[model samples]
Target: IGGGSTHAWCQVYLPGAGWVEFDPTNGIIGNRDLIRVAVARDPNQAIPLSGTYAGSPDDDLGMKVQVNVICEAVAGDSMGASAS
Candidate 1:
């Protein structure tokens, strides 16, 4: 909500804990139901085919996204969020 991109996530490293990811935007405390494409030391690091906008200070930009999550039917599985 501050600038550039709309979402962000980070991981932390503890001595014996290795690396753990946390997504503050979705209140997700772990890497469950997520994918790790690439890791960066700095959030500003450039991603392949990624770009930035150069616009007037007063100009506004916007985007909209829709997400639909479906769970696969696994044997003896009935523990998760159900879409309604």
Candidate 2:
């Protein structure tokens, strides 16, 4: 895994490669840290986060969310080396 800011990206299916990921926001190809959270033919179908809260207007304090990705070295593998 790698560390980067949260951004939206999409994937395309290639003939021999199958599904490949692309990050238009960062101009990245074959993203290393991107995780597939949802799959949909339309962008509106795949939502990163959504929810509803029921409470008094005055009681609502809003919400705070943070996401972090941590990468761990596999057994017998060098931390600085890339996996094939």
Candidate 3:
């Protein structure tokens, strides 16, 4: 984890591919343009915020998030399965 007043999240793993990044922080997933600092032994260790503040604490923090998943038809991908 790094130092800041921020938030972030990760993605589930695929069979062939390794862990891809999914930002619950910014509602973005597998965005190659975004930067990934580091990963950890466990997901809990990868928070974007973890530090102390020296100044007087008087400010408030609030955040909002949204995610959208769309599925479209693709060639060569089977939909139905045959049962014996």
Candidate 4:
């Protein structure tokens, strides 16, 4: 697993490929263009030391994100996963 302030993702080693990344956070699959910094057993280990620093003793914070999935059919391919 790996993570950064901008993105976090995990990878599995394949026979032919060193590591295939899968972004559980955003559900994105393999790609070399993806920004990656480190890898570990889990995401927390990839964060920089400063990432855990709090602004102040009394500071509080919350975060929220939204994701959407859009699918479409190609000229010669089936649209859904089960299609053949």
Tell me the deviation in Å of residue 15 in model 1. Answer: 6.1
Judge candidate 1 against the unseen true structure and give its global Cα lDDT, from 0 to 1: 0.65
Q: Please, what is the whole-model Cα lDDT of each candidate in the order they appear?
A: 0.65, 0.69, 0.58, 0.63
Please provide, for model 4 over 1-84, each residue's C-alpha lDDT reduced to its tens digit, 9 standing for 90 to 100.
233235666777989888788777666779654665566787677764434665886775644434354557788885565834
The alpha-carbon lDDT assigned to residue 56 of candidate 2 equals 82
**Comparing 1 and 4 on TM-score, the stronger one:** 1
In candidate 2, which residue pairs clash? none
Candidate 2 TM-score to native: 0.43
Of 1 and 3, the candidate ahead on lDDT is: 1
As for model 2, its CA RMSD to the true structure in angstroms is: 8.7
lDDT (tens digit, per residue) of candidate 3 on 1-83: 23232545567797798787776656666855454555676756776555565655676454443435466667876666456
Instruction: Assess every candidate by TM-score.
Output: 0.40, 0.43, 0.37, 0.37
Give the candidate number with the greatest TM-score.
2
The top-ranked prediction according to lDDT is 2
The reply for model 1, stretches above 4 Å from the true place, is: 1-6, 14-16, 46-49, 52-84
lDDT of 2 by residue, 7-36 (tens): 468888989999889877766789675666
lDDT of 4 at 19: 79
Model 4 scores worst on lDDT over the 10 consecutive residues at 62-71
Better of 2 and 3 by lDDT: 2
